[model samples]
Target: MAPRRLDLARFAGPTAEFARYLRTETVGGFVLLAATAAALLWANSPWHGAYEAVRDLRVGPHALHLDLTLAQWATDGLLAVFFFVVGLELKRELVIGELSRPRQALLPVAAALGGMIVPAGVALLVGRGAPGMEQAWAIPVATDIAFALGVLALAGTALPTTARVFLLGLAVVDDLGAILLIAVVFSTGIALLALGAVVVLAGLYWMLQRRRVTSPWLYVPIALATWVAMHEAGVHATIAGVLLGLLTRVRADPGESEAPAVRLEHRLQPWSAGLCVPLFALFAAGVPVNGEALRAVVTEPLGQAVAAGLILGKVVGIFGAVLLVVWLTPASRPRGLSWPDVLAVAMLGGVGFTVSLLMAELSLDGADVLTAKAAVLLASAVAALLAAALLVLRSRSHRRAGSRHTDG
Candidate 1:
């Protein structure tokens, strides 16, 4: 019993540390933004050719079909680590956090559905008859977790904790929706043997977790194999990370100090946030914003459609969905959030990054690719600025109300 008590005390330390890490992710957000700015500047400068050269430089084993460009490595390889952390966090939320309740979970799930559907509709309507309109509609359907959460941390620190949790849950669901869309829309066809291997490996990992097997040496190889299998299966390798995270046992076993999910999240989150995500941004966000690119974005239906979907569509979709859910269903609105807070966060959902770029690459070609990327960048920037203003206003209002209460 005494030993168990000591283990419990130790477990609490990492749990607390994980929460602190989540709060300080603002720093990682800033780092990511800095990398993005640098990429843009370097991409536009005289050294632009060198930047492209480095980005396009390819290396890796050819036999396994692993050879890919530096940019592809950043997106396909490094971002997997980031998504693994996201998976862990999301599973935790489902198990113990705001999303644990069925009623509470419904809100974000509905909002995510709305966020995706409305944007697709908006893009389709606006980009009607345009080249690539068929697939490019998905470009504005994602909300970047890192960028949205970071901006919230910067602008809404004084707001209630529930608002943050709501946004986190919403963003996680939103990204998952985007990933599923990629799977269905872009997949050439799955490699059945490799996918089957991933299923078997993931099952073994789960069995081992349940049996409380704790050897990194054994797990590391299996995890790597799962990732490889997923890649070979013609699905995004990052899905492997999410699958493993969900399979990991989040509950601590008897006499165990910490849950496996919590422990792994604490250790891997720093690497994901500090290194993997920022590197992904550096490589992925280097779209040209020159006069020609800007002109294409503004003058073309594709660009106008994406911008509208992000700025106007996200707001209407998210906010309207929340209201509809509250009025029409038994799902309880998340506490500590008001209509204003919801609206502000809804606006923040418009700042789609990361996945939007991938959609553009997958869906468009030639100068149209550049045009789509430029639209994404410009639209996301506008969304971020608008969300920031609303968030700041809400934070100040919350603070002033708190002050009056204290004085009374």
Candidate 2:
């Protein structure tokens, strides 16, 4: 028999309620977008100097080569936390989730590759002779999981689980590719000693997991040391976070309800989504959006390439890739995903906010960086709006279809 709940229970559970809300992609998305808006406003407001001063303010132990601007901390330090969350998710998916099967994973792998290749080609073709074209071409080759999934949650409520998984898997693979590029392309000359330390520390982390050690005290310091080593090696510190996350044990023990990886991810996800990512945006998304910047983005070849790669290339690359694979091979679109749904996801892929901003900072300099960032913001905004509209229409279509079936 069911027991009646006491009225006092309702008042006792708001913390759980608040936590539940924070777990949603909708809340995370809106938080990130709000931070971005606030950043832009503050940067363009009368107190613009404060924004720059705060962002450029450096605070770290210079002896360990850790002294860096606050903005750099957000990018290299905090974003690492976000990527660690991503790595845990990817590991789970590969082991037991949607990507467990080679057959099921092929579609997203193809989509990710196509999503990357076509955008690079588009950027290259358009910005061939531009100053930073060599590296800037890779900017739009990545996707922002938070923004994309958030937009989906808001507009794609009626969409099937298959669609969400596809997008999630695609973005994960896309981020992996971008991480590889950062390691290979954007890095300065490597310090072999620091590189060796990173490898050793990461290996030690794996050994700790194998031994069933679960102390945060030990892991946190090692992780921090690994981050510093990676930075010293001229590789991005975020890569260290991903490597550590991947090394963490995900399978539960006999008496455990959740694996260590799962436990850590659950605890860290809220921080990553609600604070780490938003703070990154607060520092990174403060690019000037004045007429001059907008004009440069629209008129300059480099800016056009970035905008086109994100807005046009993503749609064509992703959608066309799915069609080609499904038509030419044994792969088929996931069940319940229609052509319109695919198109909407393709557009959402263009909402390349986080990594695109990182890429802009990494690849360009001075005015070029400013212009590229402005283009990223503009393109992301347009893509989100268009994708939202299409998703809403698709949602209505789904409702009508469901209604007809029920009536039948």
Candidate 3:
């Protein structure tokens, strides 16, 4: 008998969804790079002072203490849009995607946890005794999904589907960990009244979602109120986005084409990828590189820790965690996923661009912030290069093996 053909429908939902996600992220990665390049050029140009002026320009109602600079708006306000999408994706995965099954989810979750803890530990060790550096530990714990997926996309058909799924699951969990750190570690000056208002709004949102209220007008105001309340409560406003996203109903009603979460994610993905993320990159990635600034980035403890934590810490932590899990439970390793593949993905996990920049801004100030930003950019670039090289090799190896099997 001929070898039985593998059924495709069993994997259709997740595979198709992941493919769509990767395509959007790949395109967004190019846009993000262009924005970063423009920001750098503008910052270093003769009109650099004008760039700073634009970034520092304040707006909003001063009486409410809501007046914020252009850069602050980019980091705080625009990033919330990005996180909202993240929340949707996370909920979908938990409910119906790769993470729905405990066996399938365990490896990536373990990897994500290790990816976070080890980098933080390394950062803390590297920044030991340095004043004000403790807060910067979270900087390297992020993995920029767009950049990592874009690099993997470059491998084209040679890459394995299993590898892509693994990376996506790992990156999603990594983002979740980063968000938790932001909410718990970075928040300050708790305003109980404002927080209580946020809680009430969240409860209302959840009730509406459970009731299957799909009107955007009704939900939009609630989301805005929640965001404002969270901002006033000294928590990052983006946390509100995640909460709203999580509360979105993922299961579609009868005769519906898609769930509320899927519909919203599809509709908002373009805005998140094309506009929100790139715009944030434009504001966040522009660092005035001068001789003095370069020297500080090189010599500063904060900068060194961030760079080292991202490049070395992520690879060691993620890969080591995978090895440990596989050793402890041999059956836990997913079929067709190899050690080399895990290693390559671990390297990709070190590309902590978007969230890392946000964390640096929140954790440091003045020159330290600039130094940390520079370090994040440098580390992300290095990680991308390393990951790309490893993925290319792995792709070629897979292609050759496929040819041999087919010829047989």
Candidate 4:
């Protein structure tokens, strides 16, 4: 038989729509930044007691151990919605986007691995011999795509489209790594019976999609059941969102205008961006800043490690990985992207805002937790400012080069 042809047209519509979705998310990033600022201001203001009261207030069914504080619900529940969107995007990428081709996918995958490893290694080295500091190593291993993209958007239209694509791909892979870390590293007890139930529910969910069941009434309950089971199984409940999203059907039926996965992602994107993520930021980003906490963050090893890992480790890891890959396989670097472009993108990768905060909450508690959060906030801000400046300079250089070419 002759070589089989790949159906490239099958992915065109979804890919175009996904690009549009990313543009919308840039706007959401602004909203997210505002929410984070509000939380920080509220947490440190005179009304700090009220903010604490709201965050700690619990309302859920007691028998199910669901009566958690508002902050817990934000992380464990609302963040699941955000992860569901992430899952949908990841599934799309794996099936038809850039990741569909192994050659196209290699750069981002390798860079993400490097980005995560170097940061965690730096955190470990900095936190060496400090009690309870080792647990904070994962804090800087994530990249907040929203905030990074937002910074890019603010840099005007001079930035290369290739750069945006590269950053998006890298961040998605980084998220996959962080999710695995959350599942394996943070989970304490293994509740086998409940885990089995979760597996069963997951199977049922797969069956529902296979049958082309479009009713949310039927699927919602199963999704919720899976989430509850995962929580009870001592696994992170957000994994349920990711699993369900990945298992959803991505290809449309012959007569349909869109795939089920596309429809769900489009419908849920607003909720996830507008409410879920911002609300999580509101609760999670409210680290109280005071003289004592500020002093501790500057003096404490954990804080120093987390900050350094995010601000410096990301640059070294991502940029170094790109350089190594390009040097070993010269064909790996995409045309029109130079080393400076990679360096700027790598700098932006340090903005580990949202998921970094979540990991801090999961890994540390008490003064350490507060200190880690403060460090994350400061480090993320520094990274954003530095990335913004680098990106602006890069954009101006690109514009001037283009103008010179046109004049010639």
Candidate 5:
């Protein structure tokens, strides 16, 4: 009898833990969204130059341009820390989070893949062989996990817990695809010496892991060195965080216990949720648009293509692909979410603020940068608004139906 009871309790564990995690994510989501909006207004107001000046001023050692503009440091530097958190999340998920079980993993993984492939295909078509247009290919592929999850959180008791979990899992996989896209597509020039140094550092990091050096301080210096080396190696420096994080040994086996990795993730969750992400949003989210910028968004090929890819491509590609998968594979639908709920969540997937902004900065140069940024702002804003509206509507309907059932 004791053994049977233990089995039942073990079955109940994930459901309860996930419920608590969903609540935490929902609250954190609200705070992140508010901070991001405040930053946008501050960056664009009459004090815009102050925003630009603060971000652009350099502050490192005399010999090192180590002091990048506030924006560059946020996007290229601090955001690497964000990616480190991402690496942790990815590792955790693969080992135990949604991906731990094949049945649970299929829907989100398939949905994420469809989300990525369709957007790239659409962007490439829109680019239409123009000069520099090819660089825009990866822009549509990112799903801003924070903003997407946050918007769902604010939908106010309408989104079911099941839908929320599915969205979070889907976003993680989508982000993984975006990371791969960056490492493979955006990197054009490679410095062999810098790459070699990065490899050597990675080896050292692995050795440290083997020796069980789990202290955060020991890894900090190594992380910074890896970032510098990767920056010099002509790969985006942020990839350093991803690689380093991949090497970090989690103390606990999530599969067996809430391992060391899970513990670290929980500890860092608030910092990432509160500070790193919000600050990064403030520095990276601003797109100061003028009359000229409006004209460019409408006229520039790259800007126009990006806007279409994100706004149109994301909604159609993600929802449509999920539907096709459901039809083709009877086994593929996500549990705990109805088709209507899934479609509503698909609209939410359209909120591509963080990753879209990062891609705009990296993919365009010269005068095009301004235009691309404007496009990203416009596209993301529209997507978020539309997605939120649909989700609110769906929730109302779901609530009414539940009430009717209760009354019956």
Candidate 6:
């Protein structure tokens, strides 16, 4: 029994170490955002017609009938990959990240909860009972960790490691809240038969897991079918990504074999983060905003709400909640992260990308809501810029402070 346990530990050690290395060296999220920015610029450029034409272009077999505009393919199809990655991250954090411990999770969880609550409240206040605007409340609740953390990663080594971990945890909790809100608030009318199909598919997935079907290919068709059924069933299709990711395996028990989900997540990480996310960003993060549209953004209620919620509410809410947690719970602050570092992270929280875009689709009028979307894009850009700037400043400040202390 002891020999078996020792052997199992030896096998699992390398896998866990690899997972940590991936987390530490993550560049996919930032690369995706950068690609997304370029796409947005191109879509709104003089070649806007070409951009639209490419998205609307279609090619597929009659039997498959897979015809989608470039945008739809990116949003509806590729984003499943993005959501899948999100699920893996969420699982990892729950298993080993900041949320691994109940006590360690409390601060970020509280901060995320407050961040979600206050932004929606602010959006409601500003929406002023406008028709269809209530649905927009959840728009502000998400924190784009990739964009946010990418901004912080720019600060290099000036920031404390704990601060980044804290932000990462906070963002994960924020995403979980966003997922729940989507399930409850944003879900459209349901199709019972399609939902039943989804349930059956879920059962099949579990059975496969029980039977130890470890090959990822076995689940691919099932996952694809689940996404299609979800789309047909009127659930936001991205939830399929989350569900499928959860269904994947992690490491096995100490003395048992490695879990298939963990193996799958590890295998899929490169593709999901490296390929799917970047492709999705490149296609989805574009809006053809002209000079006229820019002017209209100020008056557009949807635009105003998204802009305010992401830009102002994110930083204000995160910072305030962090402070409140520290005040209420002694020892809440992580060692080596001064208030300034916390402030820098709060600023990075303003970069709302994935959830922001998703919410824009759900809440905004689209086509007609072009102005509002332009507003969202513009606001997101501004927030990213501001957040990056603040992180840079904080980095310098921390370095200078360290130098002075050393001299003293």
Compare the candidates by lDDT and give the number of the best one: 2
- Weakest 10 consecutive residues, lDDT, candidate 1? 1-10
Clash number for candidate 4? 0
TM-score preference between candidates 1 and 4, better one: 4
RMSD of each: 4.5, 4.6, 5.5, 5.3, 6.1, 5.5
lDDT of 6 by residue, 1-408 (tens): 000001223435676554434343236455666787788888978887887788777755435445656666777777777677778678767886679888889888887887788777777777666555768777777877766666666764587888777877787888888877877787888989999988899788878877768665878899989988887788888888888766655557667655555555555665665566677667666676677777666776666776787778877888898899889876477778878777777777766777767776767675535654665677777877877777788788888989999999
The lDDT of each candidate is: 0.82, 0.86, 0.84, 0.85, 0.73, 0.71
Estimate the TM-score for candidate 2: 0.95
Q: 3 or 4, which is superior by lDDT?
A: 4
TM values, all candidates: 0.91, 0.95, 0.93, 0.93, 0.86, 0.86
Residue 354 local lDDT, model 1 = 76
The model with the greater lDDT, 5 or 6, is: 5
Model 3 scores a TM of 0.93
Model 4 steric clash pairs: none
Candidate 5 segments exceeding 4 Å error: 1-23, 26-35, 62-67, 129-131, 250-258
Residue lDDT tens for model 3, 1-408: 000011233335774555354335567688889999999999999998999999999998898777999898888888898899899889988999889999889899889888999998998998777666779999999998888888887853486677778888888799889889999989999999999999999999999988888788999999989988999999998999998989889889999877898777766666777778888999999997777777776788887889889999999999998889888974365567678877988999889989999999889888788898898998899999999899888888888999999999
Query: Model 5: number of clashes?
Result: 4
The collision pairs in model 1 are none
Worst 10 residues of 5 by lDDT: 1-10
Tens digits of per-residue lDDT, candidate 1, 1-408, equal 000001223335776555445336476667778888988998888899999999999999999898999988887788777767767776777788657888778999899889999998999999999999999999999887677877888999898988877787787678678768877787766999999999999999999998899999988999989988999998888778878887888788789867998788767766776677778778877878878889888889999899989998998999999999999998767787789999999998888877788788778888788888888889989999999999999999999999999999
